[model samples]
Target: MSDQLQNLDLPYFAIFLTFFLAVLSSLLVLAPTQRGISATWDYLKQVKFIERNGIVVSTYIVIAVSLWVVVMIVAPQFFMVELSFHDGTVAADVNYDYSQTPYTFNNYSYVIFGSGSDDSYFNVLHLKVFLRTIIASVCITLLAFVLCYPIAYYMAQTAKGGTVRLLLICLVLPFWVNEILRAFAFRILFGSSGVINSVLIGSGIMDEPFDFIKADIAMYAGLSYAYILLMIFPIYNAIESLDHNQIEAARDLGSSWSRIHYRVVMPYAKPGIASGCTMVFMLTAGALAAPQILGGPSSLWFTQIITNWFNLGDWTRGSAYAFLFLLSCIVFVLTVMKYFKVNLGELAK
Candidate 1:
């Protein structure tokens, strides 16, 4: 096998060593942790706590959880992580024959430092686009939160039965259309010669049309609108179960509306706020269609970079980019949880 290996770049020995190291690391890190968790779960089962709490705690449930973790999270991410560590150009065959080549961290290095011109701990171009995506996504989350919170509050606390149902229908109606179609609709509406521009021209408000897409205002608006429901429903669900009498008591005690929300409502809705923000931020960060359709020429989303890498037949690079993007999202989620002081366990509720 070594004689058949004619490559030095992605050496077979390196691959074997890397694979060995990865397996060793996994065992070293995961063995005790997994053992502890398994022991704890077993203890819980022995005590009948899980079953007493309405959980089945059955073999089928255990199998399902194992299968979900292995299939949904472990297997895919393991392959991607492996791919991200490989040097595709060196020993990779036409079909990514990595037999002769070992995995390398060059893919990550390339994306992070960009050929080492200025190895100042950052790849300027990639970092710029990444930060732009993060900032824009954060802005979209905040805008959606601000825009939907009041509406959700009204629907949950103030609206009559008929009005609440009607508002919910209105909220969900737009989602009946596909997300891609909605993005395209925004494209036409924000185009230079589209509805808004035509209206301005016809009304004599302006002789010229404004280019929303070119200015990237359309991108921002589209992203906010794209994930607006994600921001609304979580908040609505959280607020709906609140005791209305507390609000009434606050009102009777001369608490203003803003005060009522700030002191009472928002504190109760932290979990929903965290959940909504996490969803909106992640969706906007990973959005492809809305940015592709409504973003300006200069507006570059980081996901597009990953897409381009895959299109260019570079799965290793694409996987590296994806992992980095995923890391950023995880970091953002953690930051949100920390800031809002919401437990991950609470997000599901």
Candidate 2:
């Protein structure tokens, strides 16, 4: 840890170099050796297809794809996975890069098993938070759907041109402010001496102020509001495409309002419902700002654990936590898709 020590990154550099060389060698072996270089050489000859699009367009596409793959997605995640497998230590604590430390499952084991004993507080607390997050996210999605459906229907179907434009402006106005600022606004509204309390107390509605944040109501409300737009637009787009004549014909057949919506509107909106619910659920589960700003002490989301690990200089544990969270969200998405009987192509629409 002392300044007198030589470069501590040397060991880590050596390990990285080894990994790079191994991958490069494998790629080289996979390249063709026949006709000039081999099948790989023949593959390079396939560049003619790209050239058909014109050199400029081909060059731009290649650069964009390469950047997306290497910089935006693969490289960072690849290193994070590598970090997750290694037991990371502070560089200041040793003479070497600590790269000599054997790779481990300790980070993942800590998460799956617990921070301490099998039934420790951390183990129980984290599990509880994870479950609560999933349940709360689903609840938020349902709430948003219920609240937005009527408004979306009116806007997309019944509203005239001016009314539609006005409603859209209303929706966009609230989001012009920063998301964190909106969260803080919710915090103020729910605080003990804040707007709700002032009105309730003035009206003699209760004997004392209610702690909405402590009760976690603020978190639920904030999350639902935060992702409301995601739910609205998808359903709007789906319903907008439906023929009004079908609804009129159903009404002519003496189908009640409930039956009309149940049999007609909902079937047409299935893809939108699936898409919106999945997006809301994922966003709500991964939410940090709303929970941090508005949730009570009891409302511990999984992202908080990831942040704590990083602040404690434990990148391995943090990466493991992040990866696991991603896997859980992916599973939830697949479940939503299955329940709606919609494939990826349908959902995209």
Candidate 3:
């Protein structure tokens, strides 16, 4: 089965896949729903103005959106998904001809079970890394919500115009620095002989430099800081859109602060919370830089493993790993949507 797919045509496959996706999307968009076909028709009708934008302008806008969806979003993922089912070794042998690669699930098998060898029959290490990545990502999402919610609420509800502007400046200023530079700054702060340890030892707080990096403290801190803004803004927007009179009514009815938030604020903010959580979880799970720079010697991120496979010219296996990660993220998003009862339309709003 080494060259089983050698006769396959690449262009034909791409065209077929694109056609299939178009049909699928059409069905989804045209389905009978309150906000599906009807909403689309409304949008189209609204496009026709009294001082009309020309048909050419509208055509250009549609073309631009289509190109962005197909070229930027769909094509890369389609190629990756296609690559995941093939054999990289055979492709490499045939001068990187993907058409010559036979299809196999050996890559996914390797993810589930070790090379069919006697000594290591289970891929325990990689599985553990996958689980660790998921768990850490969830923790980070929760932590970001806990930390940012109050600030978002303060900015959206309590703070005056100038105070809100000052808070926004403080939040946005740090992120203006490049992410890599920020990661490096974290490394310097948490490194063995870095500032924290230097201060501790110099001031007689501790005799030896504590290993914050080894404890994975820097990784958590860095990842949290990196995605903090993403978690905050969605929540702020949601809360800001809420009617302040509702909160006042709750208070007038003798509701405590905690009860008011739990009953009134939280239910209204579900869409924002769900959106923030999904983004943070996915970003943290797939993170490379913070894991690379702030992670300890003993630490390993799932993305680093996928990157290694690609770096070693095993694009097939890398694609499989990446696709699997993507599937996991999709599942997480669906679960969150289900739990929060926040659909795509609400999140979009």
Candidate 4:
């Protein structure tokens, strides 16, 4: 076997193998691609607006959407996942040859298990940070929901025109400033000698300033506040579409506020609640500015580790971490949908 292998034309064999795989892949994808194209064309032809908008305008719209999906979304992700398979050490080298470099799953392995030098098998430190980030994000999502639901209910069902306008202005006012600036404002307000502490001391309500920043309270508050509008608007939209007569009927039946919301209001607002929760959770998980500015000294967010890897030129590991984070977020969204019994089409609404 060794003698025969040594006698073979290795380069020619490699070329033949590559060509064979390419042909096989193309054959596999060709049928599905053709079917998708045919379906899209049929749908476009049946669309009502095509007659008014004309073929040229419709063609331009399709082109724009395709370009946006391919260029802005798909291409970057494809490159990222491609880069993740390479050895981080080799990928970081300035003079490295891409084709000659070997691929390895060490980046992902390190994410799951400890470095080879470690006595323990699991990557406890990184896993702990990842779990903490997920839990904190969930808490922030729930906090936003709790704070926004009442305001949303009022805006949808009870508030008069002038009152609604006033509430909207108040809600939208703080968001006019940059997010980092808002985080900084929270930092100031929650600082030891900041407004809250000062007021408490001035009124003789407390003896010494509390360390809200060190306790991680500021980070939580900032995260909750940052995405409050996202939580509010969706619930309000869902509740607004709900008929007022149902709430009136519930009240006429002597239903308590809690019972009304639990049985009637909430079931109708499932899609909106699910959408808002998904948005808030994803945003909170990905947030860097608020956590960096307001987080306690001991706090750690998972994105910070990913940023560190990229900043240090370990693109392979960074991409792996990023793809992992993206996958986790996608799983979370799917879980939320399953739990709420809502589908993607309903959530989109």
Runs with alpha carbons beyond 4 Å of true place in candidate 2: 1-55, 89-100, 118-122
Off by over 4 Å in 4: 1-38, 91-100
Lowest lDDT block of 10, candidate 3? 26-35
Q: What's the distance in Å from true for residue 210, model 1?
A: 0.6
Clash pairs for candidate 2: 32-37, 32-38, 32-39, 32-40, 33-37, 33-38, 34-38
Tens-place lDDT per residue, model 2, 1-349, is: 3541343455754664565454344323322332334554366458574657887887887689668757866577666656765676534243324344556667777776675755554667767777888888888889999998888888878999899999999998999889999999999998999999999999999889999999999989999999889989999999999999998999999999899989999999888888788788888888999999998987788888888888877777888788677667777777767777886666668
* Model 4 per-residue lDDT tens digits across residues 1-349: 5754564456644643453344334323323233355776786677764786888997899789778756876667666765665677764447432333455667888898957777778988888999999999999999999999999999999999899899999999999999999999999999998999999999999999999999999999999999999999999999999999999999999999999999999999988888798889999999999999999999989998899888888877888888788777777777767777887667668
The TM-score that candidate 1 achieves is 0.84
Residue-level lDDT for 241 in candidate 1:
94
Clashes of 4: 0
What is candidate 3's lDDT per residue for 274-309, written digit by digit as tens?
A: 778878888999999999999999999999999999
- Candidate 3 stretches with Cα past 4 Å from truth are 1-53, 91-95, 118-120, 199-205
Query: lDDT at 14 for candidate 4?
Result: 61
As a whole number from 0 to 100, the lDDT of residue 78 in candidate 1 is: 71
Clashes of 2: 7
